[model samples]
Target: MLYWALVFFVVALIAGVMGFGGIASASAGVAQILFFLFLILFVVAVVMRLARGGAR
Candidate 1:
């Protein structure tokens, strides 16, 4: 998930550099949304792990 967000971010940057305004904006939006979703999921996973005593 985080990987995808990074991919989209890179794509957005490239598109912006290439002057693809619409594509850049859309990719940036997707990247932002995916990043937040990934963050939320990561936090939840960490909390769950801690709740489970941090066992491997």
Candidate 2:
């Protein structure tokens, strides 16, 4: 998930550099959404892990 976000971000940068405004904006939005989703899932997983008992 995070990897995809980074991929989209790189795509957005490339598109922006190439002057494809629409594609750049769309890719940026997707990257933003994926990054947030990744963060949310990571936090949830960490919390769940701690709740189960931290690394022995």
TM-scores for candidates 1 onward, in order: 0.91, 0.95
Local distance difference test, per candidate?
A: 0.97, 0.98
User: What would the per-residue lDDT of candidate 1 be over residues 1-56, giving only the tens digit for each residue?
Assistant: 99999999999999999999999999999999999999999999999999999967
lDDT of 2 at 51: 93
Residue-wise C-alpha lDDT for candidate 2, range 1-56, written one tens digit per residue = 99999999999999999999999999999999999999999999999999999857
Weakest 10 consecutive residues, lDDT, candidate 1? 47-56
Clashing pairs in 2: none
Q: Where in model 1 is the C-alpha error above 4 Å? A: none
lDDT of the structure predicted as candidate 2: 0.98
Q: Which regions in candidate 2 have their CA more than 4 angstroms from the true location?
A: none
